[model samples]
Target: MNHPMVVGIDGSAHSSAAADWAAREAALRGVPLHLVHASPPLPGNAVPPPAADRLRHLGEQMLARTVADLGDRHPHLEMRGEQSDDSPATALLAAARTAGLLVVGTRGTGGFDALAVGSVALRMAMAAPCPVVLVPRQPAGAFGDGVPAARDVTQVVVGFDAHHPVSETADFAFSAAEARGAGLRVVMAWALPAESVSPRTPAVTEEDRATWEDQEVAQLSDALRAWREKYPRVTIRPDVVLLHPAEALLNASRGAQLLVVGRRTDPQAVDGRLGFVAHGVLHHARCPVAVVPHVD
Candidate 1:
């Protein structure tokens, strides 16, 4: 049978939180948990030494301890951990390729000198082979804070952008919400361009802006009209707010149990994919963010 969730972990507090979340999710799904940790290889020019053996030994110890902790807490879970000489993102991406789901902490056991997920998570969410969940280790209130334990609620808030293909995310969010008997909120955000500043006229005109706003509203309505029809039994609140798409969605996600977004691989991007707003939410959204990659 396939593993339900494959999680990438290091000993950091953030990673521990991710493992906890993943393990709990696995238990909920009645599947196994595959825990992984990765280390970089020695420089090509460097000489190999027997002393390096201790580093691999420590990795095994860390993995063993993590698995033990998880096993103790969840006796029914099938758990295992592995250490790789590859980069964290690479190893986790590979693990994600086949797993039913992939989970990672927004931050990791990296240098104290740098920030987490602000960059690395961006890369993985955009290119990972399967759906990726970036769990925020900090409290649920903000980017860096830790949330106190609450009931394990499973409501899902899905972000919709005209550029994103929403059908798959909608299906996932709906099923997860229904399975947990949780509410679902479908959100759309729109922002109008600033009024043209003219020295000749002191008055700002809402004419052009109104037209743009109307178009946006129409598009959003059209996007969800069919979905609302199909999922009538599901309580979905469709929202429209004036702000950056990323900010609007992130704010809506504050009370959500899960936030879902899509991964866009724009041919114009450096990595050849990654939508602007989706990228921002993946790196900064307060809750765990799921990126449903475009399959076609």
Candidate 2:
């Protein structure tokens, strides 16, 4: 449809906010906004009876209302609305295949619980055809009486694993930073082994603690040096603590607007297993996370 942004809309207030945001983004980018509402189909074995007919009618009404409401606010925008019989996640992905960006609400009116990322949002983010923006549900009257400010900066805080290539992540992170006119922070977290700490020793000698700390900082410096040019404005931060990388990132994200991580490139042994660190952060990080698939 040549839309710059494709946004999924349900009846939730969060969805309305997302539509508003998408409409503004489209206007800024000088492109059309495509609105989609997907409805799951009835069982294939079921007959096309009165109940099935009623369900279809309801779906149409919902789509119509959503389009009308959003269109009212953005009368100058070129908006296209559609209702289709497909799972919400699948349908949105299909519609976004040709879009420049996809915007989704963190929660929806669907039966799924809204603690973390909604299922559809997560699925689309993991395998979307383009970049996806996950917007949280703001409090009542948050976007009242005026349009909120546009996000001029897109903070991409990347967690680089020691064994992984920092250059790949840094490349993409810099692109995002430059595109949004934001500064990038390249972070390296070092996990101290339990063996390093002694139960009997109350105060360790300065020489001993300094030895371990130096090694950790040196490793982080080497990584930063390799990608120094890509992000000249990048801030290098190192953490040497007794915590898992995933847990450390979750806490570090308090100051970040977006968290960036690379897709696992670990070779699955005969058993075929993925890296636990990537899985952990993806499912639990408080802020929206961007998983950059391996560069071919």
On lDDT, the candidate that comes out on top is 1
Off by over 4 Å in 1: 1-3, 44-48, 112-119, 139-154, 162-165, 192-222, 225-233, 266-272
TM-score of each prediction: 0.78, 0.66
The TM-score of candidate 2 is: 0.66
Candidate 2 lDDT tens digits, 1-296: 14468989887866876777777767656688888887776788585777777877787897788777767877888888888788888888888768877888877886456455676766665666566666656421233335542332245567776546655556666655555556666566664545666777655567877786688767767766756665566654455543577877666654455667665333332111224665676556545555554532
Tens digit per residue, CA lDDT, model 1, 96-186: 7778788887877654535547455666776676777888875344434355434333558888765454687777677656655677877
Alpha carbon deviation, residue 296, candidate 1 (Å): 6.3
Q: lDDT, candidate 1, residue 237?
A: 70
